[model samples]
Target: MVRYLILRTLIFVGCLALTWLLGLRDREEQLLAVVIAAVASLVISAVVLKPFRQQASADIAERVDRRVERKREKAARSDEAVEDAELRRPAGDVDEGGSDSDFR
Candidate 1:
Protein backbone atom coordinates (compact mmCIF):
# COMPACT_ATOMS: atom_id res chain seq x y z
CA MET A 1 0.00 0.00 0.00
CA VAL A 2 2.76 2.39 0.90
CA ARG A 3 4.66 1.58 -2.25
CA TYR A 4 1.61 2.14 -4.38
CA LEU A 5 0.93 5.48 -2.73
CA ILE A 6 4.51 6.58 -3.21
CA LEU A 7 4.46 5.61 -6.86
CA ARG A 8 1.19 7.47 -7.41
CA THR A 9 2.57 10.58 -5.75
CA LEU A 10 5.62 10.42 -7.97
CA ILE A 11 3.45 10.21 -11.06
CA PHE A 12 1.41 13.25 -10.00
CA VAL A 13 4.51 15.29 -9.24
CA GLY A 14 6.04 14.32 -12.55
CA CYS A 15 2.92 15.39 -14.40
CA LEU A 16 2.76 18.67 -12.51
CA ALA A 17 6.40 19.35 -13.28
CA LEU A 18 5.89 18.52 -16.95
CA THR A 19 2.89 20.84 -17.11
CA TRP A 20 4.93 23.66 -15.59
CA LEU A 21 7.71 23.08 -18.07
CA LEU A 22 5.23 23.22 -20.95
CA GLY A 23 4.41 26.91 -20.13
CA LEU A 24 1.16 26.19 -18.29
CA ARG A 25 2.70 27.90 -15.25
CA ASP A 26 3.13 31.11 -17.27
CA ARG A 27 -0.60 31.27 -17.96
CA GLU A 28 -2.61 33.93 -16.09
CA GLU A 29 -4.95 31.26 -14.68
CA GLN A 30 -2.96 29.26 -12.13
CA LEU A 31 -5.96 27.05 -11.45
CA LEU A 32 -6.01 25.99 -15.11
CA ALA A 33 -2.44 24.78 -14.81
CA VAL A 34 -3.25 22.79 -11.71
CA VAL A 35 -6.41 21.31 -13.24
CA ILE A 36 -4.69 20.31 -16.45
CA ALA A 37 -1.84 18.78 -14.53
CA ALA A 38 -4.21 16.86 -12.31
CA VAL A 39 -6.24 15.54 -15.22
CA ALA A 40 -3.11 14.49 -17.10
CA SER A 41 -1.76 12.77 -14.04
CA LEU A 42 -5.03 10.98 -13.43
CA VAL A 43 -5.14 9.62 -16.98
CA ILE A 44 -1.54 8.50 -17.01
CA SER A 45 -1.69 6.97 -13.56
CA ALA A 46 -4.83 5.03 -14.39
CA VAL A 47 -2.90 3.17 -17.03
CA VAL A 48 0.49 2.99 -15.33
CA LEU A 49 -0.82 1.97 -11.91
CA LYS A 50 -3.16 -0.81 -13.02
CA PRO A 51 -0.91 -3.60 -11.80
CA PHE A 52 -0.30 -2.02 -8.41
CA ARG A 53 -4.01 -1.38 -7.95
CA GLN A 54 -4.79 -5.02 -8.80
CA GLN A 55 -2.18 -6.28 -6.36
CA ALA A 56 -3.57 -4.09 -3.59
CA SER A 57 -7.09 -5.27 -4.31
CA ALA A 58 -6.00 -8.91 -4.28
CA ASP A 59 -4.16 -8.43 -1.00
CA ILE A 60 -7.23 -6.90 0.58
CA ALA A 61 -9.43 -9.72 -0.73
CA GLU A 62 -7.08 -12.37 0.63
CA ARG A 63 -7.04 -10.70 4.04
CA VAL A 64 -10.82 -10.57 4.11
CA ASP A 65 -11.06 -14.22 3.13
CA ARG A 66 -8.68 -15.20 5.93
CA ARG A 67 -10.72 -13.22 8.44
CA VAL A 68 -13.96 -14.84 7.26
CA GLU A 69 -12.36 -18.29 7.44
CA ARG A 70 -11.23 -17.68 11.00
CA LYS A 71 -14.70 -16.53 11.99
CA ARG A 72 -16.26 -19.61 10.43
CA GLU A 73 -13.85 -21.92 12.22
CA LYS A 74 -14.60 -20.24 15.55
CA ALA A 75 -18.34 -20.61 15.01
CA ALA A 76 -17.92 -24.26 14.05
CA ARG A 77 -15.95 -24.94 17.18
CA SER A 78 -18.62 -23.26 19.33
CA ASP A 79 -21.31 -25.38 17.69
CA GLU A 80 -19.28 -28.55 18.26
CA ALA A 81 -18.85 -27.63 21.93
CA VAL A 82 -22.59 -27.25 22.33
CA GLU A 83 -23.13 -30.62 20.68
CA ASP A 84 -20.55 -32.22 22.99
CA ALA A 85 -22.21 -30.74 26.06
CA GLU A 86 -25.61 -32.10 24.95
CA LEU A 87 -24.10 -35.54 24.42
CA ARG A 88 -22.49 -35.51 27.92
CA ARG A 89 -25.80 -34.72 29.62
CA PRO A 90 -27.83 -37.58 31.26
CA ALA A 91 -30.25 -39.09 28.78
CA GLY A 92 -33.10 -38.98 31.33
CA ASP A 93 -32.59 -35.31 31.79
CA VAL A 94 -33.45 -34.61 28.11
CA ASP A 95 -37.06 -33.61 27.43
CA GLU A 96 -38.27 -34.24 23.88
CA GLY A 97 -41.71 -32.80 24.52
CA GLY A 98 -42.89 -29.64 26.20
CA SER A 99 -44.96 -31.42 28.82
CA ASP A 100 -44.89 -32.13 32.57
CA SER A 101 -45.07 -35.91 31.91
CA ASP A 102 -41.33 -36.06 31.17
CA PHE A 103 -40.54 -34.92 34.72
CA ARG A 104 -43.11 -37.34 36.20
Candidate 2:
Protein backbone atom coordinates (compact mmCIF):
# COMPACT_ATOMS: atom_id res chain seq x y z
CA MET A 1 0.00 0.00 0.00
CA VAL A 2 2.80 2.39 0.81
CA ARG A 3 4.50 1.59 -2.45
CA TYR A 4 1.30 2.24 -4.31
CA LEU A 5 0.92 5.58 -2.60
CA ILE A 6 4.44 6.59 -3.55
CA LEU A 7 3.98 5.54 -7.16
CA ARG A 8 0.66 7.37 -7.43
CA THR A 9 2.12 10.48 -5.89
CA LEU A 10 4.98 10.40 -8.36
CA ILE A 11 2.55 10.03 -11.24
CA PHE A 12 0.43 12.91 -9.97
CA VAL A 13 3.43 15.19 -9.61
CA GLY A 14 4.84 14.19 -12.98
CA CYS A 15 1.51 14.77 -14.72
CA LEU A 16 1.09 18.12 -13.02
CA ALA A 17 4.57 19.11 -14.16
CA LEU A 18 3.82 18.04 -17.70
CA THR A 19 0.64 20.01 -17.63
CA TRP A 20 2.49 23.04 -16.43
CA LEU A 21 5.09 22.65 -19.15
CA LEU A 22 2.49 22.18 -21.86
CA GLY A 23 0.58 25.25 -20.76
CA LEU A 24 3.70 27.33 -21.33
CA ARG A 25 3.61 26.68 -25.08
CA ASP A 26 1.97 29.48 -27.10
CA ARG A 27 -0.34 27.14 -29.08
CA GLU A 28 -1.81 25.27 -26.03
CA GLU A 29 -5.23 26.26 -24.67
CA GLN A 30 -5.93 26.91 -20.98
CA LEU A 31 -8.53 24.13 -21.09
CA LEU A 32 -5.72 21.66 -21.68
CA ALA A 33 -4.41 22.38 -18.17
CA VAL A 34 -7.74 21.55 -16.57
CA VAL A 35 -8.11 18.46 -18.68
CA ILE A 36 -4.67 17.24 -17.79
CA ALA A 37 -5.19 17.87 -14.11
CA ALA A 38 -8.51 16.05 -14.13
CA VAL A 39 -7.08 13.10 -15.99
CA ALA A 40 -4.06 12.98 -13.68
CA SER A 41 -6.21 13.08 -10.56
CA LEU A 42 -8.49 10.37 -11.88
CA VAL A 43 -5.59 8.13 -12.80
CA ILE A 44 -3.79 8.68 -9.48
CA SER A 45 -6.93 7.99 -7.50
CA ALA A 46 -7.53 4.77 -9.37
CA VAL A 47 -3.93 3.66 -9.04
CA VAL A 48 -3.83 4.40 -5.33
CA LEU A 49 -7.14 2.76 -4.60
CA LYS A 50 -6.32 -0.46 -6.42
CA PRO A 51 -3.67 -1.88 -4.05
CA PHE A 52 -5.57 -1.08 -0.86
CA ARG A 53 -8.60 -2.90 -2.20
CA GLN A 54 -6.45 -5.83 -3.28
CA GLN A 55 -4.76 -5.96 0.11
CA ALA A 56 -8.15 -5.96 1.79
CA SER A 57 -9.20 -8.90 -0.35
CA ALA A 58 -6.02 -10.73 0.48
CA ASP A 59 -6.53 -10.09 4.18
CA ILE A 60 -10.03 -11.50 3.94
CA ALA A 61 -8.72 -14.60 2.21
CA GLU A 62 -6.09 -15.12 4.90
CA ARG A 63 -8.73 -14.86 7.60
CA VAL A 64 -10.92 -17.38 5.85
CA ASP A 65 -8.02 -19.81 5.51
CA ARG A 66 -7.17 -19.49 9.19
CA ARG A 67 -10.76 -20.13 10.18
CA VAL A 68 -10.96 -23.22 7.97
CA GLU A 69 -7.70 -24.60 9.35
CA ARG A 70 -8.86 -24.13 12.92
CA LYS A 71 -12.10 -25.90 12.18
CA ARG A 72 -10.26 -28.80 10.57
CA GLU A 73 -7.85 -29.12 13.48
CA LYS A 74 -10.67 -29.05 15.99
CA ALA A 75 -12.57 -31.69 14.05
CA ALA A 76 -9.50 -33.90 13.88
CA ARG A 77 -8.85 -33.50 17.59
CA SER A 78 -12.46 -34.39 18.43
CA ASP A 79 -12.32 -37.47 16.21
CA GLU A 80 -9.05 -38.57 17.77
CA ALA A 81 -10.45 -38.14 21.26
CA VAL A 82 -13.49 -40.22 20.39
CA GLU A 83 -11.26 -42.92 18.90
CA ASP A 84 -9.09 -42.96 22.03
CA ALA A 85 -12.14 -43.34 24.26
CA GLU A 86 -13.43 -46.15 22.13
CA LEU A 87 -10.09 -47.91 22.36
CA ARG A 88 -10.09 -47.66 26.16
CA ARG A 89 -13.52 -49.27 26.53
CA PRO A 90 -13.74 -52.94 27.59
CA ALA A 91 -15.06 -55.66 25.37
CA GLY A 92 -18.79 -56.41 25.40
CA ASP A 93 -20.01 -59.19 27.67
CA VAL A 94 -20.93 -62.18 25.54
CA ASP A 95 -21.10 -65.85 26.34
CA GLU A 96 -19.82 -68.25 23.74
CA GLY A 97 -20.58 -71.95 23.78
CA GLY A 98 -17.62 -73.88 25.20
CA SER A 99 -15.63 -70.75 26.07
CA ASP A 100 -12.85 -72.87 27.63
CA SER A 101 -12.60 -74.98 24.46
CA ASP A 102 -12.46 -71.84 22.37
CA PHE A 103 -9.52 -70.54 24.44
CA ARG A 104 -7.81 -73.94 24.17
Candidate 3:
Protein backbone atom coordinates (compact mmCIF):
# COMPACT_ATOMS: atom_id res chain seq x y z
CA MET A 1 0.00 0.00 0.00
CA VAL A 2 2.71 2.44 1.00
CA ARG A 3 4.71 1.58 -2.08
CA TYR A 4 1.72 2.21 -4.31
CA LEU A 5 0.98 5.52 -2.62
CA ILE A 6 4.58 6.75 -2.92
CA LEU A 7 4.79 5.78 -6.56
CA ARG A 8 1.46 7.50 -7.29
CA THR A 9 2.64 10.65 -5.52
CA LEU A 10 5.81 10.67 -7.59
CA ILE A 11 3.80 10.33 -10.80
CA PHE A 12 1.56 13.27 -9.80
CA VAL A 13 4.55 15.42 -8.96
CA GLY A 14 6.17 14.54 -12.25
CA CYS A 15 3.01 15.39 -14.14
CA LEU A 16 2.69 18.67 -12.24
CA ALA A 17 6.23 19.61 -13.20
CA LEU A 18 5.58 18.67 -16.79
CA THR A 19 2.45 20.83 -16.87
CA TRP A 20 4.39 23.78 -15.48
CA LEU A 21 7.03 23.34 -18.13
CA LEU A 22 4.37 23.10 -20.84
CA GLY A 23 3.34 26.80 -20.49
CA LEU A 24 0.87 26.66 -17.56
CA ARG A 25 3.38 28.22 -15.14
CA ASP A 26 1.61 31.55 -14.72
CA ARG A 27 -0.03 32.18 -11.30
CA GLU A 28 -3.42 32.57 -13.01
CA GLU A 29 -3.01 29.14 -14.64
CA GLN A 30 -2.22 27.31 -11.40
CA LEU A 31 -5.62 25.60 -11.19
CA LEU A 32 -5.47 24.57 -14.83
CA ALA A 33 -1.99 23.20 -14.27
CA VAL A 34 -3.14 21.14 -11.28
CA VAL A 35 -6.20 19.77 -13.08
CA ILE A 36 -4.17 18.81 -16.12
CA ALA A 37 -1.52 17.28 -13.92
CA ALA A 38 -4.07 15.28 -12.00
CA VAL A 39 -5.69 13.92 -15.16
CA ALA A 40 -2.37 13.18 -16.76
CA SER A 41 -1.09 11.46 -13.63
CA LEU A 42 -4.25 9.36 -13.43
CA VAL A 43 -3.90 8.20 -17.04
CA ILE A 44 -0.18 7.61 -16.72
CA SER A 45 -0.53 5.69 -13.49
CA ALA A 46 -3.37 3.60 -14.89
CA VAL A 47 -0.99 2.37 -17.55
CA VAL A 48 2.38 2.43 -15.74
CA LEU A 49 1.22 1.45 -12.25
CA LYS A 50 -1.08 -1.36 -13.33
CA PRO A 51 1.04 -4.03 -11.70
CA PHE A 52 1.42 -2.16 -8.44
CA ARG A 53 -2.31 -1.42 -8.30
CA GLN A 54 -3.13 -5.07 -8.96
CA GLN A 55 -0.65 -6.18 -6.29
CA ALA A 56 -2.15 -3.80 -3.74
CA SER A 57 -5.65 -4.98 -4.58
CA ALA A 58 -4.64 -8.63 -4.28
CA ASP A 59 -2.96 -7.94 -0.93
CA ILE A 60 -6.08 -6.25 0.38
CA ALA A 61 -8.27 -9.12 -0.84
CA GLU A 62 -6.02 -11.69 0.81
CA ARG A 63 -6.11 -9.81 4.09
CA VAL A 64 -9.89 -9.65 3.98
CA ASP A 65 -10.12 -13.37 3.19
CA ARG A 66 -7.86 -14.21 6.11
CA ARG A 67 -9.96 -12.09 8.45
CA VAL A 68 -13.13 -13.78 7.25
CA GLU A 69 -11.59 -17.22 7.71
CA ARG A 70 -10.53 -16.36 11.23
CA LYS A 71 -14.04 -15.18 12.04
CA ARG A 72 -15.46 -18.42 10.64
CA GLU A 73 -13.07 -20.52 12.73
CA LYS A 74 -13.98 -18.55 15.85
CA ALA A 75 -17.69 -19.07 15.18
CA ALA A 76 -17.15 -22.79 14.64
CA ARG A 77 -15.21 -23.06 17.92
CA SER A 78 -17.98 -21.21 19.76
CA ASP A 79 -20.60 -23.52 18.26
CA GLU A 80 -18.64 -26.59 19.32
CA ALA A 81 -18.33 -25.20 22.83
CA VAL A 82 -22.10 -24.68 23.00
CA GLU A 83 -22.71 -28.24 21.72
CA ASP A 84 -20.26 -29.64 24.28
CA ALA A 85 -21.98 -27.76 27.08
CA GLU A 86 -25.37 -29.06 25.96
CA LEU A 87 -24.03 -32.60 25.96
CA ARG A 88 -22.66 -32.20 29.48
CA ARG A 89 -25.99 -31.04 30.93
CA PRO A 90 -28.07 -33.61 32.82
CA ALA A 91 -30.82 -35.02 30.61
CA GLY A 92 -33.28 -34.92 33.52
CA ASP A 93 -32.60 -31.21 34.27
CA VAL A 94 -35.36 -30.12 31.90
CA ASP A 95 -39.04 -30.33 32.78
CA GLU A 96 -40.72 -32.56 30.19
CA GLY A 97 -44.11 -31.05 30.99
CA GLY A 98 -43.20 -27.49 30.06
CA SER A 99 -42.04 -25.51 27.02
CA ASP A 100 -38.64 -23.79 27.21
CA SER A 101 -40.33 -20.39 27.66
CA ASP A 102 -41.83 -21.63 30.98
CA PHE A 103 -38.42 -21.18 32.64
CA ARG A 104 -37.89 -17.72 31.09
Tens-digit lDDT string for candidate 2 (38-66): 69777777866786768867887999999
Q: Report the Cα lDDT for residue 101, model 3.
A: 32
68 Cα displacement, candidate 2 (Å): 0.3
What value does the lDDT take at residue 50 in candidate 3? 96
Least well predicted 10-residue stretch by lDDT in candidate 3? 95-104
Per-residue C-alpha lDDT of model 3 across residues 37-100, encoded as one tens digit per residue: 9999999999999999999999999999999999999999999999998898776676666544
Candidate with best lDDT: 3
RMSD, every candidate, angstroms: 3.5, 10.6, 1.8
Could you tell me the lDDT of residue 33 within candidate 3?
97
The per-model lDDT (C-alpha) reads 0.84, 0.72, 0.92
Which parts of model 1 are misplaced by more than 4 Å?
26-28, 94-104
Which regions in candidate 3 have their CA more than 4 angstroms from the true location?
Answer: 99-104
| Steric collisions counted per model | 0, 0, 0
- lDDT winner, 2 or 3: 3
Q: lDDT per residue, candidate 1, 11-47, as tens digits?
A: 8888788878888766585677788878988898899
